[model samples]
Structure formats: structure tokens, C-alpha cells
Target chain A: MKIPSNLAKSSLLATGIFWVIGMTDGFHINMMAFMFISYIPVFVCCTGTILLTICPFYFFGETKHFSKRQVFQRFYPYYSIVCFALCAYGIYENTNETFLIGFFVAAFFTTMQSWIWFAKESADETV
Target chain B: MKIIITIIASMLFSTLFYDQHIGLNLTVFSLVTLVALGISNPSKLRMKETLIVMGLYLLTAILVFFNHSLLSIIANCAVFFTLVGSFSEATSSVYVKWLNGIYSSIAGTFHRNFEDKSENKKPWNEDVDVLHLIKIIVIPLVVVILFVLLYKDGNPFFEEKVAAINFDFINFQWILFCLLGYYLFSNIIVPVKVQPATDSDLATENQLKPLEPLNEDNLKKEKQLGTVVLALLNTLIVLYIISDIAFLLSNTNFAASVLSNQVHNGINALIASIIFAIIIILYFFRGNLNFFDENKTLKNLSYLWIFLNAFLVLLIIVKNAQYIDAFGLTYKRIGVYVYLFMTFIGLTTTFLKVYQIKNLWFLFRKNVSVAFMLLVLCSVVDWDAFITNYNIKNADSLDVNYLIELSNNNAFILHQKKDRMVLKSNQGARIDLKYSNYVSVLEQSNWQELSYDNFKLKTDIKSYEDTK
Candidate 1:
């Protein structure tokens, strides 16, 4: 599957981050840490991964053009973002101030990213 | 959107707090989602959706079986309920669409072409009030009434019980062996019966006459064969009724024993039905039968009859399996429903190979033949004598050790069913059984001195008074 070069690169970077996070602190992350880490880096990784998976099929024609590296780059961003947020929530769960702000941010960004991804894919497919 | 948000919130809350009720929560959420989906896009679904949903549910079940996680299991259940709701919504939508399409087509045709028709020149296709009434109200009322009746009759209030003694391990094995024997006999022992080739050359050489209708005499003879079939059927029905009444009338102990036998009989009858189906298939090709005709009404009637009869037979087989268990037979988790479906499908396939008959008649003959054979076998067996002579009853119920010793000295003793309670050892010998106020103490003593004497088993009735 030939994805756009940027999307492919994003997928690869996100894949590496997920592999690391899932095997380590990212895997152990709980609900509270998500509020802080979720919006910034984790959100970026998740959105990136989502874009990488869908972009090639949605934008490119029958010809295969995207490289493995590009494909990986496309997915890595979204994956790293979600994983980091999840890990952050796990680390800072019980603190009252941390949980309230962190949880709100995580919820807002994750849901927004999902909505934006859904709309973009739906619109791209229409063409 | 609001409902969706609420549902999601509830799911998360339930997952965190009341995990045990996850299935219930999922069911409710799936139902609401399904309703929302239908309201948003009902036009996309059709009749085939039910098949898809059933397939998906089965797939999810297989996945959950292998995964063995609570979350996975609950997710599978959620999918299952969602599929159920989606299929139901699709069915209702299809029904409404068909109804509206028919109504509008009729109304439009009438209003357009007959706008100028006078009273004397009334259109031939004018709708009647009663027909509309039937469609709008009466038919639905009838359906509701039938559903209510079915719900009452089909509801299972009592659980089936298994008997404590006399599990038939030997007979079951022998039955399987017999089936294997039949399979071998068909392939190895019996030569295939081949028919003469119906080629033109062979027909000319034999100077075969052109096809003709049967003569009057032959027609009369064939009619006699039909009458014979009818007479035999009537006799079988009578015997079945008698056997059923006798079964109901028998004592509790006898009922338990007999009913256990009856359940085995039902299973055997299912096997026999399969054999009968094979016979029907072989006969169909061999007889050169033609069941179909160009008559549409006849074809529809035949199909309708077959469906209704099949449904009824299925109901009976399931009922009998449950009833047999209740009548003191063991509940083999694998039961007659499985066999019934297998045989029904086999028979239907074979029947389709031959002539299509009225559905009710087809099922009646097949199921009746099975029920009849078992009933006849049960009636001919001298159950009491078998219990006495063959030592079929529990060993403790008979004096086995005493009988063994006495028979060695040229005297054999047989014990039959008795109202009194009894205990005997192996070899048909009666051990000393003494009843007293302190029977437990007596039982604890050495019965070696008392072993030689035959003792009748008895029950001592007592009321415990003021022990408290």
C-alpha cells in the first residue's frame, strides 16, 4: 500500500513509540496520567497513526508509491500520542489537581482526534 | 446524540462500578444504539441481514470461546445483542415497506383508471370493507391471540429429572454397533440392484409397448394397496394411544423404569426415521415419480403444508425429550432435538428428491411410524417378567446371594416387583435385615450368623416425638 511519504514516516515513528510504551511505562499508564500526557505528544502520535493508515488508500491511485518507512511514519504519531497519554494517566492518577486537569484534556483531545479522523476519511472516500 | 452520550456514560460507569451486570448494560446500550441506527438509516437493511447477523454472532461466540476473558466475552455478547436488534429492526422495516407498497399500488390503480366509473359501471377490482378490516385489524388480532396461546403452552415451568439407577451403557453401545453393521451390510453384503438400460436399441430389441395407462384391474389393485396403507396407519395410531395411556397409568417406580426405556425408544425411532428417509429417496428414483406440476396454487399449497407439518413435528420431538426426562429418565445433554433436526433435514432432502406431497401428510407418516414402532415394542415386552427373570432390577432389590446358594443345591429363586422395600446381595442371596426401634444399632452388629437366613426387607414408620 503506497501511502503519502509524510504519513508513512509518521506511522513508523508512532509504531516505534507504541512498541516502547506498550513494553514499558506506556503499557502501565492508567486513567489519571492520560489527562496530562494525552493532549500534547500522545494526541499527536494517535492522529499521525490514524492519518498514515487511511491516507494512502484515501488519496493515492492504483499505483503503489509509498515506502515502508513512510507508512510507519504516518501511523507512529497517533500511536505515540495515545500511549503517552495513557502512561501519564497511570503515573499521576490519585493527585486531585493532576487528575482533574489531565483527564479533561485527555478526553477532549482523544475524542476530537477521533472525530476529525472520521470526518476526513469519510470526506476523502467520497471522491 | 444525547442518548448516545448517556449510553456511553452509563457503560463506563457500569464497567467501573457494577462489572457483574455488564451483559445487562451492554444489552440495553446495544438496543438503544440499534434503535438510533434504524431511525437514522432503515432503508439499507433487508431480509438477508438476519443471516449475516446470525453468522456474525456465531463467529463472535467462537472467538470468545478461545479468548476466555471477561471483557472479550462481554464484548461478544454485546455484538450478539446488537445483531439481534439490527435484524429485528430490518425485518420490521421490510414488512412495513411491503405493506405500504401493496396498499399504494392498489389505491393508485383504482383511483387513476376508475375515476369516471358510474354506479352501473363499477370497477371489477373494488375493495371490500371486510377485506380491509381483516388486513388492518382482524388478522393482527388473530396473530396476537395465537402468540399468547403458544407462549402459554411452550413455557417450561418444571425441570427434567434423571433417574438414579440403571443407566443403559450396554444397550447404547450395541445400538451404535448395529448401525455400523447396517452400514457394512449395505456396502459389502448386499449387491446393488441395477435397472435395465432404457436405451432406444434395447427398447426396440425387446419390442416394448408404448407407454399406456394402467388397466382397470391394475388400477383397482393399486387402490387396494392405498387402502392397506390407510388401515395399517389407523392400527398404529390406536396402539400409540393405548401405549401413551398405559404409560401415564403406571406406578411411579414402574413409570420411571418404563419412561427411561421410552426415551431410548425415542432416540432409536429418530434413527429409524433416517433409515425411512433413505428408503424414500431410493424409492423416488426407482419409482420414477413426478411430484411437481405447473399448477401454481397446488405448488403453494404443497409447500405450505410441508412447512407447517415440519414445525409441528419439531415441537413434538423437543417436547418428548423433555417429557421423558421428567418421567424419571436421565437427561443426556445431547438429546433428541439434535437428532430430530438431523433426521428432519435428511428426510426433507430425500423427500425433495422424489415427489412433493402435502406437508402435513408427509410429517404425519414419518413421525407416526417412528412413535408407533417404539409403542409396539414397549407393549410386547413383558417388563415384569424381564425384571424378575433376567435380574434387570437393582441387585439390592433382589435376594441374589441366597438364590445363588440355593440354586447350587438345585433350587433357583426369582424375585419380582414388590410394594415392600428390600435389600439383597450379589448372587441373589438375602442378608438378614432386622427392623427394630434401634435399627441402626442392629445394622452395625455382625450379620454373619444371620446371613444364612432369608430376611424380608421392611420399612419401619416412626414419628420423632419431643426430641427438642
Candidate 2:
């Protein structure tokens, strides 16, 4: 991804990657995504997307540019800002606390991703 | 060739899914994705890959054909990751490959697209290249479309003119769906790997290496320390088990709440302790202790501890059985049984890891594959119907409300048993409401969306009505 437009695509790619990973493994995160996507619990319907859309790719998949690290770095700022805004919006509106949960989700996933990326690097050095 | 397959797959996606619910179409689409993956990576194709692919396909096919549940969908997706990981890298453990599959799917899409885009940038007229054609057509069309839509929103004349422009043939939403499908298909057909993580999984051995202590005598002292700790822990567990068995033998009739506490809170507590027991054992055996010349005493203690944990799982199972016998089964109780079974497997695998000198990865590999297979095995059963029938036959008294809360799989069965059941308060009314809804949905559903259970329930209801 050499161009500015590609940078935007990579950022969107990061969000898509994060969202799908949440779907495959993160049940609670999947719940949150559902809250955002729902009109009277599209959760069950959201589930079939796993089989029809992503599962085949998982069993058999591909992608890269600007290094994964750079792509994530570009994405991290925008992602965190959006999550923080949502978190604040919930408090301001005095709405459901699940809105506040976005910040924690952002933090928790950041730590996990960092560990996945860097901890193995440290571990391989030891090996 | 890749582009053409992608286009076909995308259009197929939109056609199958755009206006319909997930049913037979999903199963068909899943199969198509599998075929596409095989074609794209024919070199990776092997006997084992074929078996895994077919097994997963069978699970998807059978589940959808029978009683497609959320669990089946989940099982299918999870196994998909395991399938991708193992197919691409044969050496890594199942758990590692499972995670790698996700990483590969997401990262691989971007990486492969960028890599392939540089190669496929030729003029669109030469071939029906999606990316090139999309680039040439989509950018300008989208820009103009967006501006026109905005102006139409603001101006009545522009709106009327726009409406008259005969853009009815240009279904932007369908195009977008096709594009979305293309992006997704691109990922599966050209998957990638996270090399470092896979390497780590590959390198981690099951056998414990001998720790060369800075002082040779330290290994002996460490062994002594581990032995004392294990011995003390074993004594405590033995006492706990003896008392637990004695209480079981007392034959005190437990109140529903008391029994619930024993199974839920008490057993869950034991499970937590067992987790700690394994963690402590792993910590001791983490290194040189496995290779110690005089480590037999410590190893024996560890084995005993593991045995005791397995015994605890058995005790919990017995308590759960008693609860089920008294109050009957709920999905919560079934969850407890599954959790305990998993704990038992964990203990068994920990035993193998220690006794056989296997690595953590070996434990992970064995357990993950077992879990995956178990889930796939479970996908064939209609759990709602199973629970309903078991409760109706075996339960002392029914929680009619709870029974009614289950999926329509049990609606026909429960309706049939209404005369025999003694409902408390408005329970009969509740079942009536549920039955009416179930029948209505069954009658109204498209044939493609209805599973065998749904059809069977509808048939059973109709036949019963006819007899009446």
C-alpha cells in the first residue's frame, strides 16, 4: 500500500479483521457488535454469517501491505478515538452501560493484540 | 481465472443471500467456497486435507438438513479455522493452527490483494478482471451516484429527474453486496500464515528438558520442595474427597436450592481449585524436574494430585446427576456436565503430558482436536428436542414455563403431552400461546428456511389435528 488511498483501505481492513475475529472467537464482543447491528436481535441471523461468509475462508484462506504493524498503527488511533467517543456518548446520554464497555473492549483487545504480536517475538528470541 | 471465479462467487453470494434467510443457500455457498479453495490451492490438496474438508462439509450439510441451530453454525465456523490452519501447515498443534487460521484469513486478504493487484493492473478490456473493471467503473459511478443522490435528497426537480433516469437497472446495493462477497472470497482462496506463531507451536515439545542447575545439589533440593508441596496438597484433597463421599452416603434429602448450590457454586469452586492444581503441577514440572535423576517421588506426587483432580470431576458429575434426578435437566445443568467433562479431559491430558514427557503444545493439540471433533459430533443432535423429551419422560415435575421457552422443536411434543401435564396457574395458557406461534411460523415459513424438525413438527401437528 504505497498510496494514501491504500492507507485508508488498510485501516478499514484492520476494523474488518478485528470485527470478524470478534465473531469467530469473542462471543461477548460479538454481542456488542450485534447491539450495534440489531433491529430486535439480529444476533441469531448474525450467526449464519459465520458459516456462509467467513467459515469457508477460515477453513481455506489469504493478504499484506505497509506491514501489518503499520496498518494497525494507522487503525489504532481512529479505533480508540471512536470507542472513546462512544463511551462518552453513553455517559452523556445516560444510556446503557454497554456503551461504556467499548473503551474497555478497546483496551483489552489492544493488550491482547500487542501480546500476540510482540510476546512471541520475545519468546522466539529466548528459544 | 481467479478473478472470474471470484466474480461468479460474488454474484452467487448476492443471489443466494441478498433477499433470503440462511438456509440451504448457506450450505450451497459453503460448498462452493470449499471447491474454490481446492481449485486455487490444488498443490496443497492431500488425502488428509480432503478428509477434513469432507468431514466439515458433512457436518454443515447434515446440521442444516436436520435442525440447524446456533451451536451448529458456531461449530462449523470454529472447525473452519482448524481446517485452514491444519491444511496449510501440517506441523502446528490444532489450537495454534486454529488461531492462525483467523490471522491468515484477515491479514492474508490484504496482503494477497496488494500482491496480486500489482500483477492484475492490465487494461480491463483484455479480460473481465474484477479489480480492474471495478476500479474503472465503480470509482466514477459511485462518485456520480453519491452526488446525484445528495442533490435528489435536497431538490424535488432533481429527485424527479433522477427517478426518471432509468437507474432502476443499476442496483447499487446488489453491486455492493457482490463487492463484499468478492472481498470475502478473495481471503479464502488466497490464504496466508503467521510464520512465527506457527514456528513456536511446531518447536514446543511435550517432553520436559533437564534443567542444568547452577549448583547440582539445587535440583535435589528443588525436588524435595516439590515433593513436600504435592504431599501436603494430596493430603488435603484426600480429606476433602472422604468428607464429600461421606456426605453423599448420608442420604439427606436436598432442597432444590441446596442441591443447586452444591452443583453450581460448590462444584464450580472445586473446578477452580483443580485449575490451580494443574497450574502448580505445571509450574513444578515446567523445566528440569522432568529430567531429574531422582524425580520419581515428586513425579508420583504430581500423578496423585492429577488423579485426585480427576476424582473431583467424578464427584461433581455425581452431584450433578443427583441434581438432575431431583429437579430434572436444564441447559444450565448440561453446561455444567460439559464443563466437567472438559475438566476431566484436561486432567487426563495433563497426566499424559507429565507421564509421557509431552510438551504443552502436545496437550493443546490433543485437547483442541478432541474438542473440535466433539463439537462437530454434537452438531447433529437437536439439543432443544432432546432436552424436552428427556425432561418430559424423566422429570418428577415440569417447569412448564421453562419447557415452553425452548425452541419450536419441542412445541409439538409439549402440545401433545398437554392433557397428561398438570400445569400450575397459567402454564397451560403459556403453552397454548407458544403452540399457536409455533404453528403459525411453521405454516408461514418458506420451504427453504424450514429444517427437518420444523417440517416434522408441522406434520405432526397437522396429523394430530386431522385425527381430532
Task: Pick the DockQ winner.
Answer: 2
- Please name the candidate that would achieve the greatest lDDT relative to the true structure: 2
lDDT of 1 by residue, A1-127 (tens): 2224333334334433333323322222122244334335644655564465444433452225743223322332343335445545664574345334334333323432332333333333433
Assess candidate 1 and give its TM-score to the true structure.
0.27
Show where candidate 1 strays beyond 4 Å: A1-127, B1-18, B21-23, B42-334, B337-468
Candidate 2, CAPRI quality class derived from DockQ: incorrect
User: What is the lDDT, from 0 to 100, of the residue B195 in candidate 2?
Assistant: 54
What is candidate 2's CA lDDT for residue B317?
90
In order, candidate lDDTs are: 0.36, 0.65
Tens digit per residue, CA lDDT, model 2, A1-127: 1223322332333343334433332233115434344322322322333234322322332123343333333343233334335534654564334323332333333322332232223223333
